[model samples]
Target chain A: MLDHNAAAARIFTAALIVIGDEILSGRTHDKNIAQVATWLQVQGIRLKEVRVVADEEPAIVEAVNTLRARNDYLFTTGGIGPTHDDITVDAIAAALGVGVEVHPAARAILEDYYATRGGLTEARLRMARVPAGADLIPNRFTGAPGIRWGNIYIMAGVPSITAGMLEALTGTLEGGAPLLSETIGCWVGESEVADLLRQTEKTHEGCQIGSYPFWREGRTGANFVIRSVDPDRLAACCAALAAGLTAGGRTPVAGGL
Target chain B: MLDHNAAAARIFTAALIVIGDEILSGRTHDKNIAQVATWLQVQGIRLKEVRVVADEEPAIVEAVNTLRARNDYLFTTGGIGPTHDDITVDAIAAALGVGVEVHPAARAILEDYYATRGGLTEARLRMARVPAGADLIPNRFTGAPGIRWGNIYIMAGVPSITAGMLEALTGTLEGGAPLLSETIGCWVGESEVADLLRQTEKTHEGCQIGSYPFWREGRTGANFVIRSVDPDRLAACCAALAAGLTAGGRTPVAGGL
Candidate 1:
């Protein structure tokens, strides 16, 4: 059990960079962050950090260089389309000190997909451009395949297309045990149970407790989320928390409110 | 108009740091990024970048130090509650090379607010703690006030509470002209109009056009958003793009698809 816990501590982490002007301008609400985070969790890869940057080259390059160097994998969404504003591939190539080139597989895919809609124009061909020495992640939804350079992935800005790309890459990356979680909700203010929550977390090894308070139906309540890499540990911690809340004269909802 | 454009080019920029393990764990979807970005836009401050980091002290401290040094304002959300995981105050204090102290006004406010519900426990008093020499941003919804220290605003993690803090801060910061934008939607693939969009943007002196493509109702379409500090320039850019789209045999929707 101890060795297993120790081995599980080698967590694989990923960072996400969302590249677009619309998000920073507040014109579009970004769904990619949550989408990528949730998908990474299922793959047992912890999303360590996320950066939402503009469509500028320097910003994208800096983010790409900084995050990719530190994490196991770096994923970027947006700015891969066929517009003048789509500068992600170029910026990433610059960050890697490599030149950009049109990938043959990507070009073939786009050409065949666009044969009926419209012959691939120069603008549409931009989607085939990728960093030098890069592979392709198949985009089942969109004709333009996503770009994969070493540990970095350049995916579509559109949520549905990005989802498709992620689905294709599932189980391909090596990661540790999937982090498990259990949520317990109580109709009481968080401050009233802060001590109990802290002590419960302290008593439970390899577990973390997060308190999220809310006001709904004109009453104060909180949801305590307990997380662990071990399902048994997570369940034990959750049960302990529920027992504490019950002793404090509050009913604990097993799955949260 | 040239002088005015030059003056408007001096853009006030802000960076946001969203601190939470829940967001990173995919347990919660972040709404604060869009909320802060929209509010900053109305205040004429450009949201240059956003970093969503974990609740760990080192991550928060590093993000706070890095962003605060580069941008005009640095705002952080999350980890301000009355629990062990709520370590934002300590982290920010560490980042600023200052000590954490309970603010008198904040303590008073919490005490008064919690008087009828329950006496202010040590856990609740955690909300009163802030970086030394920081001012309070009044939270009308809850007793726990937000903190502000030298260009850094520490807001609540909850959407509604953060909204109240932003409402209190509206029109308080000095900023330049608010960026104006006009959106035109058309039932045409972005690749088909990529050249026209690029040329229209080049023709406009102080405007940028962002093309967002989507598929709806079994048809491909796009929305081109034209943004500029000068409203007239924005309007002209929108009109030129609209005319270009129309000339390409597509009807342009004024408000977007």
Candidate 2:
């Protein structure tokens, strides 16, 4: 089990499994990881790792097993379609030792969804496939629903569907309070004040310190982003950092992260 | 062993390690994974996984070991600066069971890099420190340089630097032919043709099919992208797919993946 004793700062690690042959072939530029990573951070969750794998059964099964065993929450996007390549549902079902078929509730959603246009046929009815003992996640856009099995929440490959499901699912699930970040960006080359920067980092015990160097117009400088669960602590660390850099002769302006 | 010997098709996997705390704080949106994935893919290399970790020794060391063991190649970004968070060199050395300090060639790169800038202090000279027995990767942007350790290539976290390092390293590595992809954007919803799509997938053994449903301007449709290492096979699969969808009364458009 992961260490969850500390309420002060418990890192919420997430593993993003981007399942699609399109991504592997460079057909689809994955927008899920970046957007999800940003969202997780806002929710005080740390996105530890991300995986992009082909729409193959063995590959998906192996990736899910590996990532699920390691992280706290596993959010998977893609392969939950009605087409031939949409095998994520089956793979996930097999991985959990569950049977996959059309669940009544999920079928109800698809049946209602298809009735308006074309009555549910074999091609369209495939959207109702759900693993045993799983709950259906309503799709506000289309009638075909998604399922939530164990800790794995499967969403549509399209960004809209994925985001819609996450909005609902994320609300129902518990999450740590959001993390706040502070950054100081100014013109001080890393090489010019390497000694003082090292000292400031040593002084700050728990806060995370990162130096980002940028070249704009010709001047070079590093941006120090200090992040912590506590906003007060972050501000305090930044103050000390600015004072430290100033006392060492360089003028630093701060804001970011 | 990863058991790649008898694979029916050429499959390659990679993991990205971002050794900086700025990412966790949302200060810098990482672009390395997307760019590198695109590059590796052009040469038929698959990027499987990625990890954005802090500069903490234990975290970096643990991540390097786990990722390297799972994938064929591991590309690391950030944490090779002249500052204190620049402990990637030492942490990697510790993970590899080797002692680390300033290797001569790495030190030379730093010396030359500093000579153009003006002077190299002991602090600035810290950028030269690299793990022992690492082959140096030439840095076209700045001279502090990156190193290649076994299958793992340690690179700059900065977007431009990492990209430059990747280009120089690409020609030096052995890779397979490029992967080809094809996409068919259909004006029909996924739920309308999911079942037939599954059957089409079951029939085609040589190609991978992915259907992505998108909503634009009150119209909802699915974009199906098929992928494979073989170009002729991919074209053949898409051809059959067009016929199958047409038979189902849904018109599928043809395009690039």
Candidate 3:
């Protein structure tokens, strides 16, 4: 009951569900959030929001359902390894009201991978399981494949494996133009240029300006990021914003202060 | 309407709302998530979930309301600066149905901070604004003090400032026993010993084992983390798990692989 034509013209967005108790426990510094967000940007899709949930089934299911329903695509990282704690596949199946079954192709791949080192034991075989009706997201870095079911893409918790899966998925998903941005850093307080930022963004069509303030070396500064889908408009907005900063008696740094 | 007696015995949990577009845009790598999570862990409070939202009021309001209502406490970082884009106070006020006002103590702190530098300009004075009925969480690093409205704590976006606020508020929040953990690293694939992990954890009550697999130096391995609120139980669980790994022909690394 959705209009495909209307969806095509609109911007594509994605939400990332980071599944791990280690992250919440502060034992593991998460590297997936940044990598996924950057990859989504390169694919011309906006990373709208991110939720880091625990390994619990209820938490995973709730996040998966909520994010998948709202965004054009939903990607999850972590909890897909071959161990007792790796239950992302099962959780996804439960969330989608489907049964989990071992995919033969994934089984064959794992079997071949472990044949030389060690035979695929029951524990290792867990990697072959996937939700019914899901397809394999080929992982070039590892033999255990990622999963792609509907709009949800289940990837590995490891940063390298997730990067490989993202590389395989490049240019496959339909997306709008990649968001173009320019940063204008100045040594002036952002509050002093609040009106200039507002007016510059308002004058530029389809552009948004974000002011990030920082205090470094006993001095205060801010980086103004101007973003737009169009490259030319982004440049124009950046130039105008930089000029405004100059007129306000601050020398704007090209990249950042 | 709420049962205060029932809440006193339960474990204290917190949810963090990171408010900034720079983070979602992949332009800024967030350091606040780890800092807050670690701080909460040290305080004996569990970080249950984290949601990163944009600077938009609707997103901030929704996240604040959803998290603050469900968890024992809600902490928000970013968007508490002096720029026009800093709208956390406004959004939080809207969510709590409170009015925004300049706290006299906060204003005095700002005046003292900037009196020798540039005096209290309107832009610098913006940092003193807070939601009505909220008390100040002292910040030794910066003049802009953090805000505390009931169970919600509003903090600065900068990591160092947030750290100062956290240091000042330490030992003030009521918390249960701090969670203790032990990491046992093995040179074998975690799937090969999944049953061992499950059995070990099942034998040890109040302990949960998490298997984090990794591929390094062209070899597959995993680090098994054992966690429990009781220190004695945590030690016992680690011993049993280590014995299991050793019997299975894998030398357990005491610290990590």
Candidate 4:
């Protein structure tokens, strides 16, 4: 396990690789992007970028290598299951230049799990396979555990199973202070306050302000999300931004419209 | 407009670039990925890849250049709004090596739109700005239209507005035959039928079969999706797949389980 307190000074960032032909084909709407991103944020690690690629081997290998090399951590969801098409393990193993073998602990777990349900057939045993030197991320929902190999975590495509893996991973990986954000909504065009947002962000170091405009109920409004590592600084920035909106004759709504 | 029928012999592919810091921060759940991918499929274009980047100019520019250079078409959603943070236009212009200009027709639309609501203020007029030599994709919901420059499309981040822009673009871009797919579900583990899928796909040229496994009600099941450009071939392939699954002692469910 990484030291959370020792890594407090450095900001940890992660990249997510969504691997599935179903997603690219639009047959499946991905819930993992939001789920993983939200989970990583609470772990105090920023999800910097996400790439959705087809289940092809070359695409998966390229994405895993590129993303895992660049970010502090890389998470992959999908293509790890009891199927020939589920080849994320093989692809990632190839990318890492390691041969895949069935982990004994995982095999035992799956054996015990399927003992009463059904005998462990060859197909069911495929779930025990993992890349060399990989550890397991426990999945309470299913017997097939997630793979964690040197900052690269491979999770299941199923939303429920992925949730279980994430639940077991809580407080295991090291991370810095979680980012805090406050949203101020105003019934005004975001362009109208472009300078104010930029100036406010400039005035506060280590803060980013994002303006999201919307047209709803025959009216235009924008939600300004102010984010910072420090909660006090985030609150102060939100207050300043709200003051700026009020000075411009627009009432700022707490939360968002 | 590109002639869709003329490009029937070639395969057209597209890449999507999702721009927003809110998405990375987990503040916003992206609805555009599936929407754009589905729309592209209807246009006979395969959505090959998607990259989610922050609201930064260089990141947007890099993604635009990389994806546009590789794919037949590139679609970008978000960051093109009446706000200072909306720098997609500037980034795309920089990538295309063109100057940013106030499109006269776009300006006219915004002027007429704001005439009854509020006079076109400086901030509102910002919507008229686009990369030089870009055409507009009309927005029925909002006056600020989407942009089309060469093979790149700049669309609104908001899902509704993006839908409007995609609606306007229907049948305009040239593409090959739209890919057709059929789903067959079986109450058996995917690995049990891995060789069946592989052999089925191998027998049917131009067809790809993807296996997605699920665990429900204490039983395992899998959905096999077969995709092909030829409808007759796709139907034939599905028949073979269903026959194979039945041979393996699994009842095939139509339209998936």
lDDT of 1 by residue, A77-106 (tens): 999999898999999999999999999999
The candidate, 1 or 3, that scores higher on lDDT is 1
Candidate 4: clashing residue pairs, number: 0
Candidate with the larger lDDT of 3 and 4: 3
Model 2: per-residue Cα lDDT over A1-257, one tens digit each: 23443643566677778887666555567777667777777666777666677777887887788778877778788877666667888998888778988888887777787777778777666678877888888789776676787777777777777777777666565556456667787677777777776777677766767678876777777787776777777788889888887787777676731
Ranking by DockQ: 1, 3, 4, 2
Taking the tens digit of each residue's C-alpha lDDT, what string does model 3 give over A1-257? 25754553479999999999999999999988899989888988999899999999999999999999999999999998877788899999999999999999999999898898678989878999999998999987779999999999999989999999999999999887788788889998776787788789889989999898888898878899988887888989999988888887889999886
2 versus 4: better TM-score goes to: 4
Runs in model 4 with CA error above 4 Å? A1-8, B1-9, B217-219
lDDT of 4 by residue, A1-257 (tens): 36654566588989999999899888899999999989999999989889999888898898899889989999999988876678899999999999999999999999898887666778778889999999999987778899999999999999889989999998898888888888889898776787788889989887888898888898889889888887778888888889998998989999988
- Of the pair 2 and 4, which is ahead by DockQ? 4
TM-score of each: 0.98, 0.87, 0.95, 0.94
Model 2: residues >4 Å from true position, as ranges? A1-12, B1-13, B24-26, B54-59, B66-72, B193-205, B243-252
Note the Cα lDDT for every prediction shown. Answer: 0.93, 0.75, 0.90, 0.89
Q: In model 2, which residue pairs have backbone atoms overlapping below 3 Å?
A: A82-B194, A84-B197, A123-B194, A123-B195, A183-A256, A184-A254, A184-A255, B78-B157
User: Considering summed lDDT, which 10 consecutive residues are worst modelled in model 3 chain B?
Assistant: B1-10
Clash pairs (backbone) in predicted model 1: none
Tell me which residue pairs clash in candidate 4. none
> lDDT, candidate 3, residue A218?
86
State in Å the error of residue B219, model 4: 4.4
